[model samples]
Target: MTLTGHSLIAGEAVAGTEGRAFGINPSTNEQLEPAYGLVSTEQLRAATAAAADAFKPFSSLEPVRHARFLETIADNIEAIGDELIERASAETGLGAERLRGERARTTGQLRLFADVVRRGDFRGVRIDPALPDRTPLPRADIRLRQIPLGPVAVFGASNFPLAFSVAGGDTASAFAAGCPVIVKAHNAHPGTSELVGQAISRAVRDLELHPGVFSLVYGAGTSIGQELVADPAIKAVGFTGSRAGGTALMRTAAARPEPIPVYAEMSSINPVYVLPGAVRGDADALARQYVASVTGSSGQLCTSPGLLFVPAGEDGDRLADAVARALTGQAGQTMLTEGIASAWQQGFRSVESAAEVELLARGQAGTTANAPAPAIFSSNLDVFTGNRVLHEEIFGAASLIVRYKNVEDLAEATDLLEGQLTASVQATEEDYASAAALIPVLERKVGRIIINGWPTGVEVGHAMVHGGPYPATSAPSTTSVGTLAIHRFLRPVSYQNFPQELLPAPLQDANPWQVNRLVDGEAEIQPR
Candidate 1:
């Protein structure tokens, strides 16, 4: 359980000859001990080579074994206990309770994927029998099933270090798809990353699987990330970070000789629309909840509401006053790192200085070193349409209120919005007609639309989607959460007229895996 400041390359702790960096405590502005080593380009190459070597054996695992492997990884992560939580909290300025919840979420998703593997439904098996007695021509036998896309490269995020770090959803989904993974640890929480990486390595060692199934690498800067995506061994990528970082990786992936899919989750300002009826009734309660969502976790979540639309009338003025009153005197929370805190300050200031944007309320700053006071700004719908600055994401406890004339203005404003992860509507039964009219417009602009709720916490389940179009995510058809995420690392292949002895188990007539399939265009349902 001891911490070793070295990159783990395929179950081996490889010390880097490159430069080193230390994790800094943002709350105290102090450096943590045992600086983590950064790997050289050659070491990174070896890691990717190891992953490529493991692809065949790793991808060919049977149903029971593959399901158990994922479950064992979840057990190993939970076994780490308080050491993991304490280290994560110290590295990032998050609370112990929050880290515990994230740990449960990480393990829970792994177990969920284990169930998915056991069901054997992710293979997507289909078969078409030969019609030999046809009048003119005979149809040949054909079968199809999904296969793993070799090794995957996953980049961790700055926020939610546990749920989005090593062995998080990206890694879990890739493993569930029977693909090897190489994770580039987030520098903000190196110790946490190493601890979780060791847990995964231990699972591989105990299960007698290929050592190259997983690797955790560290590098000084963009060199390591660029080389990883360009490597032929890597087939796909899963990333979660800023828009700039995500787009940079996309460019690198596109420029390669053999292009790969990069599923990067970038910026999202998840907007909230307050209907006139709901704003007219119990505006104070709605204001309290709105303020809570805006300031939660210092507004560091990807789904935090950054923009809110309110009607411009006497009722709207009363709601706006309630919002300002609710946000006032609130204390700010500590941010993850010094760089993040600094960037947040710069972002809020840039938007605040824009024309037609005025500060409506300001909360007290925390006592911590990097914590800044939370604030809210107000503007008009016309200004929001013309001013591009108001549309940008400020990654902190800052939001903007845009007052619109009526439902028509609300719809028009929504049309100008960028693609987002989520959009919420605070409406009542009386406002159902207006809310229904905007559903189609919101559907085009966001991945998930919620009624009478805020967009702070994301649910992890079978139907959850943590993806969107363009800047929200690189791939619109996939999600980084839920069991559906496994499809990202899978590609379907059809076999024609293959010998019975040569066919794969799932596609064979005997149904060795006992999975349901579409036979002659009809689904053969199986018991779970």
Candidate 2:
């Protein structure tokens, strides 16, 4: 199927003059289409400047109106569901079924942000009333609410092209907070991004949003990215990619005269632990479940279980055998891009070269460019503890099995883990008792802890935590999932000593416009 390609700037399809860049099909190693032009540095500057200007009026819009705009965008995304899936599959080499699910995630996220805006959750508004008659001194009445941070620079992620690209959570959350967006399209699937950009552009027109509210730019190399993040107009950045890529952008943001927040979720191993009782009772069952985790989406996820900790014994060996057998006949899967495939191959080789580990099952390398085979390895706790190299993430269908001599060794291993998005435990009652001492340490190391379950299926709910320290994400306290994600796009401001007539409608006297807030000394919306 033919796909159209263009950049959306100021609600129009603006073509770039730079040389073309090609998007290839990973499944067949075929060229999917002719190259598209990279957005010139001039275009990048213009897009950011436009967004900066757009933020002035957009951020001041009434909360209800902004919420309506978000609702409209969500509807528009849902209306074009089929087109998004088809283009995303064709452009990114993902299967149609997988793309369909991603489309839902993408639109669902947009709608979730709409709910957040309507509920004023991101506002986080608080009021502290004056006590003029109190002792000490007359206290001042102060009202506080979150304000939009301004224009945002979003770097699209390669995986989940539909959900993490142009119209993904980062862009959606920014818009929901009333900040304009300048998206740097991912090179792996520019065609899919263009289609989504068009839909967003339509939403902007239908909602009568500012022309410069959103802009799409395509950058082929380091120069475009550097320019995007370094610009002063960009109040913040959102990125999901390799550690190296995220770090580079963070450094750029830091070096700027006025530094901005960079929300970058680089990589994680998403480790899992299996206690002695569980390994002894049903090592085979646990191994089968884990095999599915390592091979899910060919293990091309940030939450993929890269490390497995097990008690060393006859049972542990039996579980290792089970895992080896399960992985033995598994077929390879299509990776997101050639760069990722190459990186996965290199990362796998690095683990195999480690003196601390032993390879249990070696997956066959693919003859084609996109396919990634499954790989499994085994090692002792001492070896892994002594070597920091064993802790890094390998972004592919691979798992490293670590055998601990005792519960103490398991505790030590848990203590050594860096911050992660999720950690799982496979434990029976006896095993749970044995590892109960380590739960606190594990809790500190990851955002979420699971029992007898995989970590890849992240639920998009109010309680979900998708961020962790350092490598997992630059901002550990903030999530890139759920309505809370909008917090990244806002900062709190307090208004004091202002007349009722001068105050914003949300905080005006007589309880006009009936929204929830602390009025006078009480929490009520009734008329004064």
Candidate 3:
């Protein structure tokens, strides 16, 4: 498959008027062929307008067709094969095995949403029969169901290029909710984004759906993305990146004449609390696991355990020593980009310069431009509690061990944390009684709480939540992963005293879709 480097707008390949940008391989620092042109503001408007035109027919489609459309997208993505993996691997510096798994996750999420559509629960249908014979005024019949919020603007992420990029979760969920999507391709992997974007376009064509159902735009800077968010046709936005980028989009959306929701997954230093029992039981094992989690994908994961809180004592000291020993055996790994690598180095230097922070260990040096050496640092409770810099996420291959003197110190540290995507407690059965007190605090601070586990791996399922409070995400009530993510692009509408023929199939008297629904506040599954 040859790369065109053109933006896909309304099913047509359109060239950008702005300057061009090339995809560079992070490992070798080599530029890939075919410079991608930046989409102009006019192109952005055209894409959004196309999406607005596509919304009604696309959203009003039968649930079965929606499921088939999502399934077709998964098939098209799979058909792209090894070329997809190679381009993504070169652009993002992620290994072939990792990209392959991420590709599977990307397609799996699409199929999962397809299943979600087939089940029809996303509609959230409810009905209330007319009570003409009862009450003083005779109650009128009412029906309710969730409807799509129109076109959505999605920003692709740099780290997980396949699973969070052009045709990833945001696009899948938006389509599942019956909204048209316009994706802003991440600059780091424009080729990869183009490939996936084309795959989705092929799916749209195969299904004979609206050509405006999906569009992909590339940009050399933020202008195109900002324009998309500010466009009147775009009803919502989905973003995943740095705090600065996410918050900027939030501000842009808020400043719009008609403000919209921005579901942005921003920075998170997922904290791991090491209970007394776990630290004392096997410090070596804990150290090994912690090191592996921190260094995974060069610590690019949003749920990476960047902070570890351990009870201060001989046990904590032993654990720190074990971690230092483990770190010495690990090698420096390639990051997603040169910018990220530079930022990691600067963050490591900042930690080293801190007065009370002690450098534990450093990984073997790398031979490339974008590789990052892993480092571990430790600080006492007093220094950690007083320094706000200690709380910021480093974004790569480093973690801070904060020694807490007692449970009170741990509570205080937890209180100092901002909202996070995940928070974990490594405890044994014996530590349950003590760990119970911290559960409520963890619940308030993070989207997901893990017990005796790491937070790096996010499962895509019905119950998973990849969102949290401010700084973690703009909206805490919604998730950016799993089947529930579809809800973010949906809003409910109630039809009162409507004719049976005018009602949507799901809310009709016959329940034509045969979906489980609430009737007069009671669960009902029977047709009519």
Best by lDDT: 1
lDDT of each: 0.91, 0.81, 0.90
lDDT of 3 by residue, 1-528 (tens): 778999999899999889898999999889988899888888888899899999999998887888999999899989999999999988988889999999999999999999888878889998888899986789889889999999999999999998998988999999999999999999899999999999999989988999999999998436888888989999999999999999999999999999999999999999999989888878888899999999999889999899999888999889999999999989888899989999998999888898899988889867766787899899988898798888889999999999888875677678889999999999988889778989888889999999999998899999999999878998999999998999999999999999989989898888777778989999976442
Counted clashes in each candidate structure: 0, 0, 0
* Cα lDDT, model 3, residue 44: 83
Q: Which of the predicted structures, 2 or 3, would earn the higher TM-score when compared with the native?
A: 3
Question: For model 3, what is the error of residue 397's alpha carbon versus the real structure, in angstroms, after optimal superposition?
Answer: 0.7
TM-score of 2: 0.95
Residue ranges of candidate 1 with Cα displaced over 4 Å:
none
Pull out the clashing pairs in model 1: none
Q: Model 1 misses residue 456 by how many Å?
A: 1.4
Residues 1-528, candidate 2, lDDT per residue (tens digit)? 234466777776766778777777887767766566787888878888888888989997776777777777767777776776776776666788888888788888887877676666456556777778978788798887788898999988888797777888899889988899998988888888877777787877887888889998887648888899998899999998888999999999999999999999888999898877778777667877888889877788888999998878888889999898888888778887777888888988898999968889866655556787789999988889888888989888988999888876776777777888888888777776766787888778788889878898877767888888778899998888777788898998889977888887666665444556655546654332
